[model samples]
Target: MEERARTEEEEMTLEEAFVRLDGMVERLETRGIPLEESFQIYKEGMELLKKCNDKIDTVEKKMLQVNKSGEYSEF
Candidate 1:
């Protein structure tokens, strides 16, 4: 199930993931959602968090890959 969701997330941009995650947070905080739906949102939020972290890690790795001249380079 998670693998399937991850596959879907691959098609989403980092910004998209952040937007969706933020919306989910707002919904969870301000609305009275059902227990089951809340759990579903929680699962989706976890996936988004993982996706965002992975994106940040990838960017950090690329940023760290610098040449001796201090310019970015392929790792």
Candidate 2:
């Protein structure tokens, strides 16, 4: 069966996104896709990048320690 492009709202793990982005890069480097499809793939890769960044930011925030006084700050 053919695989369809994933929508931004679709749930995907960071590793999965990275794999997809890598595939997109390889396809772009090979340079056989039409201009429109290339643009679409590029856009999807960008969205995946943003998702990865957001996940990292969330992990960073979670790593912060909270003091006994209820005050908290990121390390």
lDDT of 2 by residue, 1-75 (tens): 114445542467888878888999999887578998888889878977987898888888778688888898776
The local lDDT score (0 to 100) that residue 62 gets in candidate 1 is 78
Candidate 1 wrongly placed segments (more than 4 Å): 1-5, 64-75
Give the per-residue lDDT digits (tens) of candidate 1, residues 8-67. Answer: 788788888988999998888866688888888998899788888988888777775768
User: Which 10-residue window in model 2 sums to the lowest lDDT?
Assistant: 1-10
lDDT over C-alpha atoms for residue 9 of model 1: 87
How badly does each model clash, as a count of residue pairs?
0, 0
True-structure Cα RMSD, model 2: 4.5
- Every model's TM-score: 0.71, 0.68
Q: Which of the numbered candidates is closest to the native, going by highest TM-score? A: 1
**What are the per-model C-alpha RMSD values against the true structure?**
3.1, 4.5
Model 2 lDDT vs. the true structure?
0.78
lDDT score, candidate 1 = 0.83
